[model samples]
Target: MIAATADAAEPDSARQRELVRLVRQDCGSCHGMTLKGGLGLPLTAEALRDKPFDGLVATVVYGRPGTAMPPWKTMISENEAEWIVRQLMQGFPEEAR
Candidate 1:
């Protein structure tokens, strides 16, 4: 399980790179090639920055049943999803905006 790092201590450049990779590889598949959000909600910092970590983890693992989002419990470990959520909250590449 990949754990979410505390970005408050991470270098901006490193966070930017990681966020790009995650958006392109992990989130892009469902959130659209640009992560402008499709079946899933937009991954903007304004949408997630103030959200609780646990809530984000739960959504990724269990998904919103009535929504197009699918549960990812079998595909990704909880911690990995948490890490992705953390990255989403930080912001992604300019293309993702």
Candidate 2:
């Protein structure tokens, strides 16, 4: 299990860029190019406002079973997953050009 805390450090700038691309390209395929919703649920800040933060992080790391959301544990660390959830809840960043 992830040894997560509210004080988890954010990913470095370079890795942050990579995570953005992963979300936009891989995750966007289902969450929508704009994360507004598609085969997957909308990841917009508004849609996630009332949702639990840690739960979202867990979904990213472990994924929702019996669904198309596959676990990303092999690709990302728990801290990285936490960072992504924070960014998504605040309006995910666009990939750097």
Candidate 3:
């Protein structure tokens, strides 16, 4: 089980790049192409600088059920989702926008 879990995880570098790409492409539609916030709150450094990883993951996986945000489980894998959360906590990469 442990090995299976490990195997299922994305490599750090790949996950980081994938997260950057996804946020730049998909998330931009709502979060803004710059992630400076749009219909949703800014995903900027000041906004997410102190947010916890788990909270971010929950938001990504389940979304704000009643809001415009939609759960992303169908579009993104669990590992990838977590990677995105990591990216959010770390702030967007320059190339992401």
Best candidate according to TM-score: 2
Best-to-worst lDDT order: 2, 3, 1
Query: Best candidate per lDDT, number?
Result: 2
TM-score of each: 0.62, 0.90, 0.76
Q: Report the CA-based lDDT of candidate 2 relative to the real structure.
A: 0.91
- Pull out the clashing pairs in model 2: none
lDDT of each: 0.67, 0.91, 0.74
Candidate 3 collision pairs: none
Residue-wise lDDT of candidate 2 within 1-97, one digit each (tens)?
4554467678889989999999999999999979999999999999999999999988999999999999998889899998899999999998878
What TM-score, to 2 decimals, does candidate 3 have? 0.76
How many times do residue backbones clash in model 3? 0
lDDT of 3: 0.74
Candidate 1 lDDT tens digits, 1-97: 4334445344356655655675576777777666667766767778777789888878888888888777777665565666667767787555334
For model 2, the stretches where C-alpha displacement exceeds 4 angstroms are 1-7
